[model samples]
Target: MDFKYVPTTCPYCGTGCSFNLVVVDGKVVGTAPFQRSPVNEGRVCPKGSYAHEFVNAPDRLKTPMIKKDGKFVEASWDEALDLVAEKFAQYKGEQSSVICCARASNEDNYALQKFGRCVMQTPNIDHCARLCHASTVAGLAQIFGSGAMTNSVSDLADTNCAFIIGSNNFEAHPLAGRRLMQAKKKGAKIIVCDPRRTPTAKQAHLHIQHYSGTDIALLNGMMQYIIQNGWENKDFIEKRTVGYEEFKKNVMQEKYSLENVSKITGVPVDDIKTACQWIHEAEKTTAVYTLGITQHTVGVDNVRSVGFLQMLTGNMGKPGTGVNPLRGQNNVQGACDMGALPNVFPGYQKVTDEAAVKKFEDAWGCKMPAKIGLTIPEMLDTFADEPEKLKCLYLMGENPIISDPDIAHVDKALKNIEFLVVQDIFLTETAEYADVVLPAVCYAEKDGTQTNTERRVQRWRKAQDGPGESKYDWQIIAELAAKMGMGDKFPWANASEVFDEMAALTPQYCGMNYERIEKEGLQWPCPTCDHPGTKVLHCETFAGMPDGKSVFAPIEHRPPAEQTDADYPFILTTGATIWHWPSGTMTRRSESLNRDCPTGWIEINEEDAAEMGIETGDIVTAYSRRGEVDVPARKTPDIKKGVMFMPFHFWECRANWITNTPYDPVSKTPEYKACAINVKKKEA
Candidate 1:
């Protein structure tokens, strides 16, 4: 028995934990800890431990398939690629769109985006980041000139106070949560702001249970109280930030008073004051949040409010202080860095910038589009409304049918597309609608790099061979580009060569190479060969502004896009569970994870359940303006009254069916956290 352990990064969450894939006789069988990892230090979450289970699952996509007579039939790579290339050739510029994958490697994303711009001559490219951290990218860029987590993940352990809002890190991002636990063990104060009494909230010294869509009000109230008591860091604000007077005037308004904010957020005035006091008293405080803060109509406002609170308290540039928006997927950060978004090229370079476009065009030997492209929601909307305008879509590794808001509408939009090509390791729900389905390799069978939430760039070492006929995502893209007469533009021999080309174009990754990050990974802003990676941003000066100071946005609270009515009297929110990852593509295939959470359920407050004659385990029908779903009811006091919670992992009870479609104007992120719904016990 030939056995060996291969160290690689976890392909689950953005925490970027490392583990050794247990390979026996050329097959990945299990995972062991890699102690030298800087992120997890030999620790991993359940998803990471069982990540290998899905690689060799029984239903793995082994060959390419093409839809014939409304049913899929196995086909050779030449036949599928020829058909795809022929169909794609019919659509050019804005008529085509490409959806990259966050779960794929950085090399794959960079090559795919280059294909979209140079070969397809279209800027309509994006990934799951639009659904998760688009607000983080937009809001932080406006305030601090950067749109990523400002501090390292391990820095959380050194924080004196951690203000965790909108995210339950203990369940959503376990490894990062472990850092907060370490801080707690060292006497650091842990303050959580959330409506549900999550495990993380229960462990907090203070849990401010604010209502959904009221983040701006809660943050404004805290800032108001801080300024009123003269607890704010005036020196820091005056020296390191601008627009203080206008921001102060806005937050100091009587409408944002403690009592008013309490009425709006459902959080008591005393609890709000206590949270503010803890943050002010701590020497180093970090503001941590996730989708609960970004998946709203005011997502950008909410994120900017968090930045305001941190900057107001002089917590911008220290080791244990900064606004940290933990990414949901393994390589969502890397995907964004590789220019998977519509508006920017790699390294956040604007697509409209002539210089940047010229540089890429010269490098690729092709002219590129200068116009910014549509986001995921916008693409779907265009497909549904004007299918002729955006006719074809090339989606890789994304399951938008279950992940997008108002999936009922998503289903309609997908059906209207002229042509759809899906590339993945499985025949996902979304892939079922594809004209062609291409089998792709998973992380364990690929050699690449992934950027974590803290801007750390880590390596993913290949441990085993891909299933039969399955190809790397970049390889498929390159072959298609070759078929379309752009083979010269993609002449890389391996993933490392692809990385070298990408690093040459991206300023942030200009110095990064495979040799430099072979063992422990290096964080971004490592702009030179000899320079150490950056751990904290904006130390002496803000990078976003020309004046070297952060700017404050004077934002006011706005209610959710869809408010509760007499017919729909409850607020419904969607999220992920600890057992399964998003869309349940990989995790659901894992026997252990599937056994733990075999189905979906809605969390209802005990009082509400009792009032509606609903009991735990009872089938409940939840109805919204958009759609309805029947899920088992879980009556618990952990969730606030007048609100219901459901995870989006189960396809049988898709939470997105009832989620609101209205998105943030700035971030284009749907308001998944606040939608009006009505529920009742399902009759037999």
Candidate 2:
């Protein structure tokens, strides 16, 4: 196997396992973890191990295409770019909202926002993060100074206790989950707080079966117990944190009693007390969570509550103890760090500020809107609930039709989009109804840098010149800008120049350059050419950390968007499977991935299945107020009695269609957790 071993970051989970691209004879073959690298130690998962298969898949789109006469017809890049620019130009202003979704690199995401604010003349640009981690960011920002994770995955091993709530880390972040096990082996107690006994909880020294959406109450109850027993670290609180009295007065009061929290979270009172005792006893404790805590209406508050607990116990800043949110994607942390959110420019600087806006405006030679932008869910609302306000939408690398809340409403928004341009490697579910489709290059076919969960910015080398007639997304964006009369505005030779401009304009990437990351990857906030990028943040001080303080946003518990009533008895929640990416654009095409986990299946508790007269492998109809989907049921004990888990990766079983669209007023992320539904045996 004559191949070049180029080092790069894994494009799957945010764990950002560094690996080498097994390029055999200029054709990408497979991925191998960097053995010497401490993280993962040369280990890979079912998803990360076979990431190379999708690169050379025969089903990949190799040319620009326009939807004409009910079919995709090959067209020049000019045709698609003109349509996109003309439509965007028509609605170019503050009223025109643009919400970018899943997929796309940091560079592509930046171009999308610039196109929206400068050319489209609107501050209305958001990302799919609204659906995944908006609340995590928002909530973390409120409690801590920044929204990203406080500690790295390596810190998990050093902790004396790990409070993992609302996360199936074992299945989602396998390598990180193994680290948790290692922590357990080292006498670091593992606290698994979820509705089901997941693999992470199976070996857990302590597992608390908390009800969905009651995380705040459960965490508060633990804090209440800790406070009453006077188990908190007094020196750490006095020296490092603030707002202890307010937290005690607010959450430690009666509403968060053990009985009440037990009632809200569905955990036993004894279990709650035990968890509090364990956390109190441990010298250093870490809290790691995922979408299980972020996809709800009170997502941000749920996160804040966790931070409050961590602060109350002084389990932050030290190794093995901090608030660590295991991000869903490889670059989600980096994406946000690079200023992918609408309200904040790169490095999480506020876009509304004159100085910040001026920095970007001066760099682009264009004025940016002073106001904030609409979120993904908000854009969908404007289309269906509002009016013809949302007419044309150009999606770079997202599949909202299947991934967004209330899949039916998302579909309506797509139908209403007079001009829809979907740019991707393959025909995704969201691309089924597009005015034009631009053939975009995948990660393996391009050269660029992606920041991982650890905030490490690593290089991705071009293994092969793009497949067939395809072109890199960055080049496509430059072309589109030129055709749209911004040609003189966006004249770039390659992605490196584009990234350099982006890095220079954004404060976080101020000092980083290609040469700096030439050998080993560099973390952001490098600040100058002479500095090595920061490995761990808050080592000394936090970024504008809450007045060098923590804000305790105490919130009352709220029910999920849709509750279980007589008509809809069972509650259905949507999530991802290890085998698929967002909407299965690339996953379904991979032969090995398909062979291992081809179709999607609904997971139900054995008791619920027996009561509903459903057996394993029995196809059933799952319906809610919004829509209905038919999928085979695998009755397992992985879920709670009254709840079911479904992987929203397949189109045939549109889980989002049956999901509730009611969103958190603050973050606007839909409550995909607790929608009510009924399961019935399909007639043969």
Candidate 3:
């Protein structure tokens, strides 16, 4: 009986909490807290604590499986790989698409993009970010010159004021929640703006519940209030930013006045004034937001509005004074950094840029495509609308069937594709439609690096071997690349070799190497090995902007694409609770996690529940324009009247079944936060 504790980062949210996987005789038994990590100290979330159960579960895909006549049958790796290669060969350029997994490691994601562009010869490669925070990337990049968290995770502890909007951080990012609690202990004012009284809101000094899809209005109102009260930092604005005059001119318009804002959003004028005062009066204000701000039809506008507040208050380029987005997946930051998006290569180097394309082309020995590829939603839509356009789809570690918006449409797209290949640890919902399902190893069975919400890149070591025949995500991609006769371009011997190649290509990670970060991690924009990683960005100037300044984008509020009517007289929003992770891919497989949240339910306000004669735990059927789902009703004062909330985690009661598909024109993120629906007690 060999007992050892292998330290690794949690494969849950973007908190980047460290834990030690307890390995006995080459088998991972459980997780123990890693005490020396700077991010979480020695603590972890509930999902992280019980995350090990799925790794050794009996349901883990033990071997490759190929679907014939809609039935999956066990097949050897060669048979599966050969079939995938053959099918992918039929598709070229835009006809082929790949969905990289944000949860996978940097090496895995880097390998995937290379495979998609070089082997499959398509620029249509994207990940789950298209669903969650694509707006943050698009908007923040346009504003601050970089579309990532502007502050460090630990910097929250030093903040004098923390304004949390659109995020239930306590449930979504527990470590960040702890840091906020610590900051509170040190006399930081915490203000929360959400439609629901989230657990984080309960801890805030002010919890202002505004109407859904009114984030732009609320933020513009707050800025107007500050400007009217002479709270704008003129000196900082003049020196550190550009386009403030235009922003002020637009925001100071009577339409954005407190009364108008109050009418647009349901928040009282006094409460809006007070929220603005808190930020204005503070020495340093840090604003944190999550999917609540980004998963909207106007997601980019929502994000830019948040950035406008920070810039208006001169709350940037310092510790605890920037717009921070608490990312979702553990490696989501890394996935984006590794260039899983369609428009960019590794390090966000634009695909259309001749120099960037030439760099990759010179490195990989292939002339890359100049055209920007279709996004995940666009690719899926093509398969549905023009089935002949998309001939092959290769998915790695993503379950789009349950996670993507408009489940019926996604199902049709999957079925319409000529060839579908899914690579994952288990037979997920999306894998069900696959022509071939490749078995891939989980994080514990892989050695690679993951970047957290703060852009801190840390090493996650392999604790034990994966289940039978399962390979690391990078290994699987490399195997397919080799079979496709692109082995020379992807000659990585191992994950580290893949990382080395990626680091050489990505400017942000150029300073980092596996050996340098063996013990401690380093944040990106570390351009050289001699230079220590940057803890805070924009200290002097924004990285990619032409001038050393930021911009304020004045945006107007637009109603959600779908609004409640007499037919569907309620607003339905989708989210995740602390008990389960996204789509419940790994967390749902855990016995302990399942025990805590055995099923899915809809949260309705007490008033709505009372009016409808509905009680807690009563099964209810919810209907929308697209589809319907049955779930248990959970009455709570935390929710608002005429509103319903459901977590899109359980497959048995997929909340996305009834969710609308309206997306942001700029960021292309589906408005998972708001849609029209009607509900009633299920006939039991």
Winning model by lDDT: 1
What is each predicted model's overall lDDT from 0 to 1? 0.94, 0.78, 0.90
Model 1 regions lying over 4 Å from their true place: none
Error of 1 at 199 (Å): 1.0
Task: Name the weakest run of 10 consecutive residues (lDDT summed) in model 3.
Answer: 548-557
Candidate 1 lDDT tens digits, 1-684: 999999999988999999999999999999999999888999988898898999899888999999999999999999999999999999979899999999999999999999999988888999999998999999999999999999999999999999999998999999999999999999999999988999999999998898989999999999999999999999999999999999999999999999999999999899999998899889999999999999999999899999999999999899999999999999999999999999999999999999998888898899988989999999999999999899999999999999999988999999999999999999999999999999999999999999999999999999999999999999999999999988988998899999999998988898889999887888988899887889999999997689989998689999999989999999998888888899999999999899888999999999999999999999989999999999999999999999899999999999988998999998899999999999988998
Question: Model 1: which residue pairs collide?
Answer: 145-544
lDDT at residue 124 of model 3 (Cα atoms): 95
Ranking by TM-score: 1, 3, 2
Residue 565 of model 1 has an lDDT of 95
The list of candidate 3 runs beyond 4 A from truth reads: none
Best-to-worst lDDT order: 1, 3, 2
Cα-based RMSD of the predictions, in order?
Answer: 0.7, 1.8, 0.9
Q: List clashing residue pairs in candidate 3.
A: none
Compose the digit string of candidate 3's lDDT tens values, residues 522-546.
Answer: 8888889886888888988886788
